[model samples]
Target: MTEENLNTSGNPSIQDVVEQRLSRRGMLRMGVGTAGAAVLGSLSLAACGGGGDDVAAAPAPAPSTTPISLNFPAVAKSTADLVTVPAGYTATVLYALGDPLNAATPDYRNDGTDTNFETRAGDHHDGIDYFGLNAAGTARDVAGSERGILVMNHEALTDQFLHAAGVTANPRPAAEADKEIPAHGVSCVEVRKVNGRFVYQRESQYNRRITPNTPIEMRGPVRGNALLRTKYSPAGTDTRGTINNCGSSVTPWGTFLTGEENWSGYFARSATDDTARGGATAKSVVSLARYGRPQNSASRHGWETAGAADLYARWNISQTGTSTDGTDDYRNEMNTYGYMVEVDAYAPAAAARKRTALGRFAHEMGMFGLAQAGKPLAVYMGDDSRGEYIYKFVSTASWDAADASPANRMAAGDKYLDAGRLYAARFNADGSGQWIELTIANTTIANFANYRFADQADVLVNARLAADAVGATKMDRPEWAAVHPVTGEVYVTLTNNSNRKIEASGSGQQSVDAANPRAYTDAPTAATAPGNVNGHIIRFRETGNEPAATTFAWDVYLFGAEAGMDATRVNLSALTADNDLSSPDGIWFSRKTGLVFVQTDDGAYTDVTNCMMLIGKPGQVGDGAVQALEYTKADGSKLTVNARVGAKPTSATLRRFLVGPKDCEITGITETPDGKAIFVNIQHPGETIAKANIGDATKFLSHWPGNAGYGAGGALARPRSATIVITRNDGGLIGTDGTQVLNGY
Candidate 1:
């Protein structure tokens, strides 16, 4: 459906649209921390120096065998039936939504009568990472290791089913809404496999939840800016919590970096206040607008009107005091979020920090490349919105192999994150891209007519403004970026956006360019409206395939579509049910196994089945020929091109491994280097399960990770966001052959 024809009632408004544009679309047919150097000064220094000397050697390469075949049998349509995998494979649920976060709290009741969410694991787990541990319980790299710490992101909650009684659109008592806030954050769970079965260490000291209540420090250029000075921290040195943490990355030094995305919609702002504060400037207007905190805008949960509790008041972004001073007001509270938060998963005592140097925006996730001591570090990130820009952060300091020690972990982050240059991606029409630096004093950004900048903080906080000033190339919604294992080339998923059209002459805000070639009207489908629907995956190889290179060559890797969509464009890959998917999001490449995992969050195909994940052995870059793409630009001129894209995957090389339940997303993947076991997260299963019906097991849409039989109650009894373990049943390599083998190859 065209944007004009779509209804906008319950739909987010323009302001929310700005915030979510980078995040929202399916293949449419038609469609860290600091701390305590003093107390244990001796202990700290000793631990730091001691661990640095013990660099573990890389594990021996696993024996190479014939490629494994992959295929699956469709099971029951609705019930959470065990996935029919190749005969030698097994899948087990490791952790599920609502599991207790601490040993001190009561375990999950699964009966839907429990309400103590303060200590429970959050719902809708998203991005995650696996950190192997040494035999001594310290974090280390262990090849073929079964024991490690799995740090997972609890992106957000599906509040509709979080409580015993369904939540009212307009609730009377605000306390009912208060409980859900604390449950949204990151969960660091320590897990290990014993006797070939994965199990979480419930009492592990490292098991901790970093929630909205956790105190976090602000770091980088924007540290003490007036914009971040919320009442929670009058000095702007600290903030209460992190929100909307979607995807994440793990550092070589053993810390977790969770990205805060879509954090703007949580607060209530006054429209008049925003207009009065020089919000007309592109920096101010776009900042507030992009974040969805327009003045007078209401919150989805209405927490701001809930009373005098600091907890509720914190959600208010309205300017309350008469003075222009921001102390009593929250004009800048929203700014405190939308950052990359660094959390020490192992050190519960350490507070997390918002690494402002990364540049605040709708951050999807950060991915790092191989590290060398004393060498500059490189990180790749996506803005997660349509028409937004992609970014990379290159650390100023060289890596120090010694920094991997437990004691120097935070120092390692500081060494790398403290002072770094941030650059935005500009994909040219000639299959090449450049990284434009967003520095204030040394560039055209400082001389922009609109916003005045005093230092780097302004440029970092108002990065979009700077990018605009310098004229960076706008992209389709960029999400979940990863570096190719065999080649250091980077790939980003530009999920579909219906608003995009092909521009002929003059450029429009999101006019289609060579980089984003496809532009067409989506056909009416069962689950999706007719508009620009099915999206495509874009891959770029840095000059010479070097992760640290500032220039790169790119191409469209895959175009998503229905099994029988347009043969010319829609079905760019000629994909079948075995591998076709819309709105590709969570993506990862296993460096050790050279396996590319693709996950989908599609409304377009929901009429057929739930979201799914697929595995592919992608061919090397430059493996395909150029193809012609046609579209109509905003200027009403038609544009056509013959551009190169990734080779299409045959059914034999790519296939769906699993599908999620009602209203759920299949995301957050990590695998052992050996490829023996894969960890996948199912987020918000049965998300539509009404609160009133939560007590009735049969009424719930899903009871996954629990036993397949009826009424097998336990932790998994409740429909929850959870992580599952998939392994070969016969204790052999996964996807070893080109055909369906293990089961009966």
Candidate 2:
């Protein structure tokens, strides 16, 4: 039989909602770009790649707003599931899903028999940061960006492919359970350029894999709280490692913050457990339903029933006991997750932390304002789910230069992440927005019927309830966010929402609003779902164009669509063949080049092109005129709202840079300090294959980096998500020029 004939079920064996699945704007680093004449927020200079010109060595004034030029012509969109780069640039795979890091670990056999995954690379590479380590490799070396450690989050795993028997089987095998446990989390590896190419150090002192079994310290408002107390950690001061780490950010203190997303889906609950049990209340049911984890919901993979021990059972976050307190049960076990994990990337051996003061929700990612001498530090975040809200945490203490490159990075996090005000966003229809503080002091939440706020910790743990109480704007899956390099404006990608519908009294749907205005059917994911398929990118600037300001103005910067979608509806950006996308998931500003990089994680427009990354020069907030949008209300009445809509993007303003393989998202973008090299990650490339056929490597939906020539010779390519590096063949900086903006070729 042919390789494709032996395996009959080639279609994707999707779980309940796939169980899951799962920048800069220009200043210099994603947030470290220059905003207007002043530099906006920035990650630590030692954070992630992209450092050239030794500004830290000899502090100089900001560079002039000179637009950078692109030497290569834009590549045409392709149907092949492979990494496509512009002319004159080369793309090389660095680390793939099952690749080994330490010398003790053997090379991946591609037979799903690989063990000790805790020491090997994880699956589904996502957000990443590059930290320049000193020659001794003990501390953050800001002066050098060429030789640094790359910290990437393994957002999720492609289960069926990870096991020999496939993961769809009801009772998960113990061996399969073991591999799956270590497959999710973050990876830290050392990478450096050789004579002409960048290479991954197989064995480096800094190489480490943080899996779900690793110990993580819990700090901030929810730390040491009774609600988080579980049988595992009665003190509630710590929790088992982080999971679903999607988009991530680097702190100014040189620590990596990985956001835990879709964590609630991993835990299972009983159908009859809605009544008071353990420490849960009626609000628990309401909160669970709102978060899409209603009672009786099956766990992501039935990990609880995998074995008799709690190793896999601990994943069941449902109300498991009738005890007055949660200490004797795992009911509150899941609450300890769903927060940002702080890792000292420079010190791979350091204990990671869960910063709860930032609030608990499906944290997509976090971005910080440029840490100024005397100004307060600001961090922006998003909740990646349907009808979720955007958030920001402002540090109470003032910024100090001494804290920038601190002697102890984690200690610096203690001063900021531990004492901050967590606030939810409320985008007004008048083009203005407000940061609603999620505090017990807010009357709307303190007396909320669904969930009462007994303390600050209660307010944060039940943050979703508080956001609903305060009437925060319901967004369409707020995924990754970015802050402009020079405008100090925050840009968030509202990936499409399928649950939205026209307002009807009994419909119980999310109606179109100023922030999430589109509700048209172009290529619906399903017959019943037709709201925002091709999503849009929204940008906002604080009242004073400063992150310190709570009030701001917002506008839809760019709408994602197919090249020929109706311009009056979905394709609002007027995207052409050169620049078109859907569900923009990852976004960043190359402050080093004044160009904005946008990536798509969508199935909405895969028919035309695989998920790709586009480069553009974005304008500041309010660059376009206000748009009056009409909507159908519950009574079939016309409801019009005004919004600061963005202008259509011309070919000169935006162009496609690279596209990924089948059933994958183009994510995790970073460039070397000198702007000579760029790194991007391809996630879950042959995801469409079924469990039964996953073992048949030849029949896999995609051959990926291997078929693309990054893998072994004549070997059956086992599709694996991996990171690839991009560099110029001419040996110049990776962009064309004029004023650093990637505007026109």
Candidate 3:
């Protein structure tokens, strides 16, 4: 997921809180401010000091009787126009952009004259999950490996390659708009092993595409509210489609959960939109502006300029309807997006449901924690924007083991996902945190100064405002999240914040603190982000080892940097040349291997290597200790904060696994039941080519899978986003030698 830089809340920073706490501590020691002692009792002032770095000692690690080891040698970093893996592994291209899903659909010509994209594979493949099929390929079978379904999100378009002569000017032709709209949603294709290699089943009955024009039902507290009433569904029970699908996860009830990210950029609003809605003080105007769609904002692709038909005009969110309830126009269309859409890949006839209980924002993914038989389930999520908050939704119902394989999966989703309590995280200056509930019951939310609350629906629709009122801690562009199979600990990827500074420059800028403590230029004169150019991963253990805990203990798991950089400051995790990385984006743990895989979507460290994936043996959250980091402010003054860091990662613990082709993001990985094979997505290779140079193949930055002989290939073939299956030559388990025993087994 990429950073959008849309957060302009100007909420107080963690650095500001730390400074005040330190001042209060000094006064308490001198017998002043005694009245405030009770309020600060829970705050963990475990480490604090002035000046140079003072490292705290960590406890001895508990020895593992049977340690997991990497069976293959580390792959060297490469800039070559091909996917590079270990010596013993082979990566074969599988499904790709514009591949046919129906048997009658024609093959992609690669010159971009193909039509009927509603039945073709979409662009920018991302966030994939594998669902196993029975031996007869008729039903679900968790143990089946040879034949299954591959569900993935097509995030956005590399539009320059979508048309025959590239994109046309404004007022885009209907033919061009027809292809682009269907290319932005999700795809489910059936795959089976044919001759010792995996291949997509082009003629399978399970293959389906859910695009922006597909119908979706609204579920949960905000379902039929007036805020969702539009010309498409005046009763507020349905909406048109899902857009900007970024990251995804598979549910315990056999459904696919996809996050709608950056959907605000797809709509265009008129300059007089605020005035028509009763000026800036109106609730609708304030809500629209807060979500990055201020009046007169232009759409990303100008889809609204196509024609006056409802198909094209819906992208224009201006309030031009004559009815006061907005029953004749798309004024309320934007409110239906920015949600977590649920899809049952096994059931082809079911429509996707938008679970409105998981409050709206720039959603990254929805990952559930370890499910216990009688405990309330918890789903961890992150909003993918600079200075946004991480969220958790606790289902009101208790988990039942039998529901894992219910006869009706979509009904099971309603039993658990339709009612939940939403909470936003607040990381403290110390190594502890709290989950602030976003409810009207909270006094802060009820009396929020910016927007008046109408009901629970209003609070959820404007979740960002509720989080701001409760003072949730702003993070560095939180993206994908993964839960440890063994410990049930959650780790989130803070994928680089370009708006960070040592001191605030404006409303959206933030300073360094314990959780996000780094501010330096990539190079002396480099034109990258000055603060946190390379991001880090933070992990936490829920209190009492329970998923429903209200508080947790946390630490920085690892920092992203060049291996040769300053050891005390930037390379705090002590990463070696074999495993160093930057801008960690897609992350997941293999349930069978207990190893965490980290993938990068970066521009920060690209000078040394392309975006890559690494395998690591992860330790507990508190495996390392606290360290005070010194920084120079904008005025040249010095400041420091004690940050809890994780253990140093050695070659034995972390190693590079794969590097993708030129200009491609290596995202969305999944494996079969036995873990013998893994599938990965290479998105938008050669995406940096100039729009005017689309006719000249020689000027292309990359011709990726085409050059490597996968699809339509030659020196002149255009690049594409594709999925590749990797397997060991010896037919053994993917990341191991197949002889090692797991801890319990």
Against the true structure, whose lDDT is highest?
3
- 1-745: candidate 2 lDDT, tens digit per residue: 0000010111110001100100212333222221222323332232221111111332232444434444455667777867888878888999988888888899886666678888888999999877776656666665455688889999888887787667757587788888988899999999887787889998888899898889999998888888889888889898888988998877766678888888877788887777644234666666666565767878777778788687887877666666666777788887888898898877766899998888888888888765555667788888887777889888888777667667898998999888878888888777888998888888877987667777999888877778877778778788888865444568899887775555422223466777887777765474455677888888887776444687987888998888887765566677888888888989987645556789998877877778888887677676677766566665787877564668677776688889888778888887665666778899998877777676567777787867776644223577889999988788766655444331110
Between prediction 1 and prediction 3, the one with superior lDDT is 3
29-65 per-residue lDDT for model 3 (tens digits): 2100011111122622111110000111222223333
Worst ten in a row by lDDT for model 2: 1-10
Off by over 4 Å in 3: 1-3, 15-65, 524-529, 738-745
Considering TM-score, where higher is better, how would the candidates rank from best to worst?
3, 2, 1
RMSD of each: 9.8, 7.7, 10.0
Could you tell which candidate, 1 or 2, scores higher by lDDT? 2
TM-score per prediction, in order, is: 0.85, 0.90, 0.92
Tell me the tens digit of each residue's lDDT in model 1 across 1-745. 0011111111111111211211110000000101111111121200111100112334232333334334444222222433334455776778876777577777776554556666677778888877666656665543425777778778777776655665656432565666677778888887887887888887777788888878889987788887678667778778888888888776757678888877777777766765667655635554676455656777767777777777787787766756555677666688888888888766778889889999988888887754434456778887776667789888887656556554756766777887899998887777778888899865688897656766788888877667767677666677788765324456788766664555422222355566766666554442242234777788876664344578987887787777777878668778886777888888886533445778887767766667877777665446676778776544677677555677777766677767776667788887654456778888877676666675677876666656442223743465677788888777655555332111100
